[model samples]
Target: MDYPYPKTERQAELIALADALAGPIAARAATVDREGVFPYQNFRELHAAGYLGITIPRTLGGLGADVLEYALAHERIARACGSTALAANMHCSLIGRIDETGMWPAELLERVNRDIVANGALLNSANSEPDLGSPSREGLPSTTAERTPRGWLINGRKRWASLAPALTHMLVLATVVDGDSPPRRGNFLVPASSPGVRVEATWDNLGMRGTASDDVIFTGVEVPRDALVPIDGSATPGDGLGWSAFGGAAVFLGIGQAARDAAVHYALERKPNGMAGPIAELQTIQHRIAAIELDLLQARTLLYTTAEWWVARPAERGANMWRLAAAKYVVTNAVIRATDEALRVAGSAGLALTSPLQRYFRDARTAIGQPPLEDVALTTIGKAALGLSPGGNRDGAANHDAAVPVATVRSV
Candidate 1:
């Protein structure tokens, strides 16, 4: 698929690299999805294409692509395979957020950037805990780290850690020991080969089966003090959530477009006994395809435009996280609708195990459940429209006490 928006010479070149990888990625997607296995080959290809460190600074030997470029990559990769794109999103979003936000030490950031650029190391932030639900919501990770003379010893469990099987580095969110004010929340970056780190394969889902969002167990995992990155507990403060939302929107947009393409292809080839020609020749089929095209156009426009806006104004995003959430909500919802419509147009044949449309439908549904979930997005929009203040940050442990048990929505 051609890129939906205009790009700079560099952006167009980078996007071409991503587009070139789509074939092999799509070829492996079905088997990976069927077996529920991690797409290591896909990651290797992305790494070889220099996508793993695309967001890292050029000074640090990375592509130094902007937010729009990143989103375009996500959208294009996802067009071929949703699972591969989804897993890549976890790695890209985490690193992009760290680079853009600059909360950690310069040396530490440089080390991470060098690792990605030089060695093709993959990283993802593990924050979701089974007990407290979504980290973006009223939950702090129950993972705890103790102060050691060398550094910190981390021992805790993280659920839905995307790209776990392939992670070269993990940013573990944990509660730290404080004198008396309160237990501080810090993110500790631990190497994947650490003696105590374990990846438990627990991701067996109806959609995005190849993402490998399994459980990551940290048992006495040790990291230096420099590994601990400070986190501000406000929703609007960090760039991580915003970037992740954009990535999610891009994934669904691709999935939806794929579904439309599949349906149209099937319609053009399949002929019925009573009909004079293929389904595509029918007026009804033409109208349904037109509707799907309209949805794709609207969703793609919002997805790219918002990303460009963020690239143009990074400072305002910290205060306008709601806009990011809204974009995710709009594009994801549109994709889900497009997939459903495509299924209707394709008839029962689309539900066959051999059909890609069925897989697209399942993948698109998962988009609605990704971070800054639909309910949370709606709440944020409502609060903004009502002129209410976004709430103050609650300490990590304090949040656990008041957090009610809400339905867990996993993002991979």
Candidate 2:
């Protein structure tokens, strides 16, 4: 599991650490998936290994790694367990965004960094609602935060709350209501132990069951006025969605690589009843393996290249979002194709409960609906290629009213 690209000493070190933890994590993946339980033990290891604060700045007692390192480490972890990697991605992406964009207030940022560094506190954004769906779409949150005499009171039900089983804090998006003023969206930092915060067990799904991405109900959850982190509508120096897009791509690519490895191993060992040698000698098997490798090559190249470009060219990222979207689109679909081909290579054994390939297949399918889904990615790329703005109008005249802002929106 050598990294395919050049890396600094620090990046190599982090990747190696992730690889080291992957083996033990992979061993427990089967039971975690079977029982649909959260990988609490896996998180303990990750936290103890200092991966929980990998993205926070060094001054804040963290590794201060960038997006490339984050992507690389996540890929290694995902190669062992998609659920662990995906759930961790939620926490890492939030910290990554806060680090990349100096958007949060100094006190709030310091508090979050301290929690992660000192206590390995895990956090995630609660954005998607049952009715509003993904926040990436053009709709305001139905969740409301009213200004109270003492503080802000929040009330809403958020679905797909990943890491709900052990969240220390949740960045909740809610529409703010003030006296005689129009409603505005705000990102409120709500502690998990709030008086009215409750997690409902409703996350049984097709795959990634270990994520514990259940529903969280916030009823009259109160937070201080300082808890409200204002949303800046204007574009910033860093791309807010970079971590989500690249980190997610790496996870799926890792899953694809695992499938490819499984197929190769099985092919080299399985000898048919009448064959001269193992299935590795078969032309059809070789062709499928070739296809899997080709997909991996394409996906890795695009995903890593885009991530490097993002790190190298920060000032130009706002204009180059389509490239990030394209990487995600390509990696997810390539991984899915690779897994399907791997299953074909393994034949009946791939479908057995004892085989990890079936689990890989199910987990890979979950990547399709993550943020910047297929349709959304295609729409962004299509618009960019057609010389139109995000609003779908020509000549770069974007209709701000209709455009969806690129914020931190997570999926199950």
Candidate 3:
């Protein structure tokens, strides 16, 4: 009920900027999705408006607002454009993770922060491979990062490298192979223009088509020693992924709310012959709309509440992880259900490409399908609630994550 995030002047500026950034994108969301084209103009507006640096702290080039504010900003963008929102969510959130870690070279982090402020440079995980659906934590990667005299030589193909076209850098994750030490997997920060790096541009996606989530091939791509920056070298990996994951739900949930709003607008205006009133007067339509409204309220509150908790106490391991998993699981499904209901309320017209409802429905479906799949979350939660362990009661990683499937590509 009360304000959920910081009310600082910078936060207010970001809120105002986010509204401005969404305006033009809101006007073109449907067409961009239909044509599968990037919203460069919209991105420029956001870039110029400084929403791209919403997560960056003032000490850095960013406004440095709280996490909840970032999530709210994400919601604003997502309601206007799913692709842009998702891309910005990843970029704004990860910069702090790597920045705090003092992992990579200090010079590299400065360059990254500067690029994010000046050019809207984004960072995406080039971790997904053709063989592995979601890169396994414990799984051995086929793409090998071997240490060389010059630097790390990363060779592998990464699928679903979203935001490839607009990104200034790529965070490529590869397993290190060395005869000298025990196996350790490391994440590399490589510039988009490095040698032997190519985007296949095959972004034929079912949803969020404008994202430019193409397959990137890294053939002997060598990132200089400076590029293999690790946040862990500077900071622990604790709570980074969970905070980042739940942080984006507000955006997806807003999209569902947008779809619900659209359905309400149509219901209030459209009238059928002999029906004494607008579609809103009909009992069936009101019933369907009410269901969507409930989902929006429940999901949105959960998103912001959990976001606030993360901001207040990011390292509260048990509480943060459990609550975040619940929020991710709940809001994702809420969007799916809300979108489906919106389609039903809008009727056949909802299926038209010209209509925003159709785009909203499709994109919401894709958004919810993200990893830490709902089914897995339910299992993990159920296990956690009871005294039982997550997966392997013996080890925490096993309980939370399944054994990483070793991925090796065999020629088809």
The numbered model that scores best in lDDT is 2
TM-score sort, best first: 2, 1, 3
User: What's the TM-score of every candidate structure?
Assistant: 0.90, 0.94, 0.89
User: What are the per-model C-alpha RMSD values against the true structure?
Assistant: 5.6, 2.8, 4.7
Flag regions of model 2 displaced more than 4 Å.
1-3, 231-238, 390-405
What is the Å distance of residue 202 in model 2 from its true position? Answer: 0.4
Global fold similarity of model 3 (TM-score): 0.89
* Candidate with better TM-score, 1 vs 2: 2
Name the TM-score of candidate 1.
Answer: 0.90
Show where candidate 1 strays beyond 4 Å: 1-4, 179-181, 231-242, 389-411
Per-residue alpha-carbon lDDT of candidate 2 for residues 1-412, written as tens digits (9 for 90 to 100): 3446547888889888998999999999989888999999999999999889988889888888888888988898998998999999989887877766777878878888988988989989888899987787757899999999888999999999999969999999899997888997888999999999999999998889899999999999989998888545545633456877788888899899989999999999999899889999999999999999999998898899889988887766666567777898899999999999999999999999899999899999999779787898898878865656443345654333334337456757
Better-scoring candidate (lDDT), 1 or 3: 1
Query: How does model 1 fare in lDDT?
Result: 0.78
Where does candidate 3 stray beyond 4 Å? 1-12, 100-102, 180-183, 231-237, 389-412
TM-score of 2: 0.94
